[model samples]
Target: MVIVCCSILIISCIAVVSSGMKVSLEVDRPWLRVHLSQRAALECCYRTGAASLRTTWFVHNQPANGTAVPVPVRASDQVSSGYRMRGGVTCGTLTFAEVKVADSGLYRCWFNDAGVFTPGTYLQVYEPLKKTINLSEKTKDNILMAEGFLLLLCVLVPSATLLCKSKQLHALEQKKATREEENIYQGLDLNDCDKAMSLYQDLVANEQEEIQLENP
Candidate 1:
């Protein structure tokens, strides 16, 4: 009869422990963005009525249908993984020595105590801070591009102007040379007076011969 009475008491205690209880989950930060090779701490705080609890950490991905995959947290020379328990509360800290690109995802903390499980706190981990060109960098790039264009214009415009001026100068020199050659030819003709008189005598002789042939 004593054994039966003890079993009944145990059953009643189990029933009371398994009853609905209020619990809440809290995180230190709502979102986090970290760089590669940097350490990240995902702090989780759970408030529950249970005196003792067992907590599990998981990484959930949407492609996996929000399934909670358990993360192996062991105290190692590289990474330290552990949890702390206080009066009616627990905090689990997962630390990484060096973060990688594959480590970016959503994390959650699950707890179970006395058959009651509380919803977890989600911790987001990022792979690394992306190298982004901010407004100033973009503006600097634009300025550099504009400067390059202006420099090219400065070089090309002067080269084009010099080329045009050289063409114009060459034309003027050619015209001047032609005019000087014509003046030299005129001076030579004016100096050859004997040759002009001989040509006029030959023309008069041919005209007299034509006139005598016509009269005969």
Candidate 2:
């Protein structure tokens, strides 16, 4: 009889502890994927009133091999390394302003007073893919041809201008030299004509004196 009574007491104690440890929290979104630098949220709802229980959040960063360590999330209105807590009585939200790859983890919500925790949500943060512009072969060829034409114009235009200017300068120099040569030849011809006139006048005066002497 004493053993039977002890068994009943143990059974009653087990029931009481089980009732106290009953889970009342429900977490939303079993899994989530978000790009880096985007906003992400984890929500927890409870059947019990807010007056009876307080909600808390914890995160476990996924590791490469071993088990992850859980870290408590701090509540704040400003941007923090942790998360911001929002919402009213029935539901609580943990919000990240900008999520990073390091923010990828398992998140759990707990009711400290009720001793209840919701099944965790896994968040995967990924880098966004880079954008690329696709061009057709025809378009690429057109662009290349246009660039080549512009480059050729850039080289040929200046070269043509320099060649024309050099030709003009050479023509001007030749014209000036021709004018100088013509002026020098005209001066030499004028001096030679004056000398011929003086020599002829002296030869005529000597011939007239010889004829007069022979006649006398």
Which predicted model would earn the best lDDT? 2
1-216 in candidate 1: lDDT tens per residue? 345434533553454356555445543344566667788777566666655346555655445575545463445565666777777667777777776666665555545443322233343445545779657888999999999999999999999999999999999999999999999877775547888988999999999999999994
lDDT values, one for every candidate: 0.63, 0.71
Error of 2 at 38 (Å): 1.4
Cα RMSD for predicted model 1: 16.3
Per-residue lDDT of model 2, residues 1-216, tens digit only: 345434533553454357574334443567889988888877766554335356678888757787778888765652233223235336667788888788888887666666555556788999967769889999999999999999999999999999999999999999999999999887777678899999999999999999999994
Provide the lowest-lDDT 10-residue window in model 2: 77-86
Segments of candidate 2 deviating more than 4 angstroms: 1-23, 49-52, 75-89, 131-216
Candidate topping TM-score: 2
